[model samples]
Target: MPRPLRSENLQGTLDLLVLKTLAARGALHGYAISTHIQQVSDDFLRVEEGSLYPALHRIEGLGWISSEWSTSSTNRRVKLYSLTAAGRRQLEIEQKRWDELTLAVKKVLECYG
Candidate 1:
């Protein structure tokens, strides 16, 4: 059975997803980032602007990402976000941790089941 999606769970995974998305898709604006996440997750994940912007700021502060103002196709100014080298390195470490954590959880669940 698929696990239920919970807010707390989503919050924890959002950063990882964001980093992976930028790594794969290159630079993207906030809305594009949210849309990509939603689309890729088949609507399972929705990155609200309130949550998304703050997360972006936090990651940028962490040197995992950087942003610059750019004009969108519609000629509106938007901040385009891209992963930094540090961010790429962080993503690798986080990916390992995520894999280990999920494997442990799966083992625990299977053991109890």
Candidate 2:
């Protein structure tokens, strides 16, 4: 079974996950993105809609993402989000940073362990 996520750990990783999801899936609405993350994590991570919306808006503002109103699978109107070309570039950069940070953290833990 998957362990529960630590919010502090998740905080640093959320953006990468979002960007990766958008890259892989093309476009997804906010709720779908949240559900995808949760499912992918095997329900170990829980994302609040409030936090998700603000993050989406922030990414959109950063020009890393874009959104448009569209009908969901349920035929309900929703704002669909997709990664921009800039976002794809940003994801590569961010992913590199994440890998470096995780390696550093792992090294530190190894030293102490």
Candidate 3:
């Protein structure tokens, strides 16, 4: 059996992922954010706690996202993260960057291979 490619180096795209996820799914807790990314990517993208929480905090610090304390289904206090207007704008920027990056990679692949 072949091994699945490890996407651990996806740190560069973490901000875009979080922003897009919150934009699409509305507000979600930290763990929910992690799981959502993994599930959406068919388990190919795994956001570890060591990586995710920091990104969440950094994004909140940038004022791209707002956090609120909310009770979860399990009756535990959780911080819900939601996208802000700035985040939406950032999402657009990130999307553009991603598109350009993919296009560039495709060109390199076509030229070299």
Candidate 4:
């Protein structure tokens, strides 16, 4: 079984991934967003609805995303979310920060080992 997703484990990264997904994949419902992330990561990352819904609400509150009620392919009603201009900008900034942090970690690992 996959490990449960902890909010602390997500932290800053959730917003980044959420924003990037909206930017890249266009509008998606909460469940679709979670599934996209998990699929893209080859199932390495599993985002629970409990964690995802809060992040979606938080980012939407920030005006980073906008949503509207829409019918899914299955004819079920869902709130689809899309990235705003502000969200696109935020994604760029977050990607840069992530790159920097990973590069720093890579350097530390290389030097110490």
- Per-residue alpha-carbon lDDT of candidate 2 for residues 1-113, written as tens digits (9 for 90 to 100): 86777434578677888899999888999888888888898888877787788889999999999999988778989999999999999999999999999899999999988
Q: Which ten residues in a row have the lowest lDDT in candidate 3?
A: 1-10
Q: Estimate, for each residue in 1-113, the C-alpha lDDT of model 1 and write its tens digit.
A: 35435334586788898999999999999999989888887777777887888999999999999999999999999999999999999999989989999999999999999
Every candidate's CA RMSD: 2.1, 1.7, 1.7, 2.1
For all predicted structures, in order, the TM-scores are 0.92, 0.90, 0.93, 0.91
Off by over 4 Å in 1: 1-9
RMSD of 4: 2.1
Model 3 ranges off by over 4 Å: 1-8
Position 40, candidate 3: lDDT: 87
**Which stretches of candidate 4 lie above 4 Å from their native place?**
1-8
Rank ordering of all candidates by lDDT, starting from the highest: 3, 4, 1, 2
The residue ranges of model 2 lying beyond 4 angstroms of the native Cα positions read 1-3, 6-9
Better of 3 and 4 by TM-score: 3
lDDT of candidate 4 over 1-113, digit per residue (tens): 66655545877799998998898899999999999988897776778888999889999999999999999889999999999999988899999999999999999999988
lDDT, residue 53, model 4: 94
Candidate 2 clash figure, as a count: 0
> Which candidate would rank higher by TM-score, 2 or 4?
4
Ranking by TM-score: 3, 1, 4, 2
- Which number leads on lDDT? 3
Stronger candidate by lDDT (3 vs 4): 3
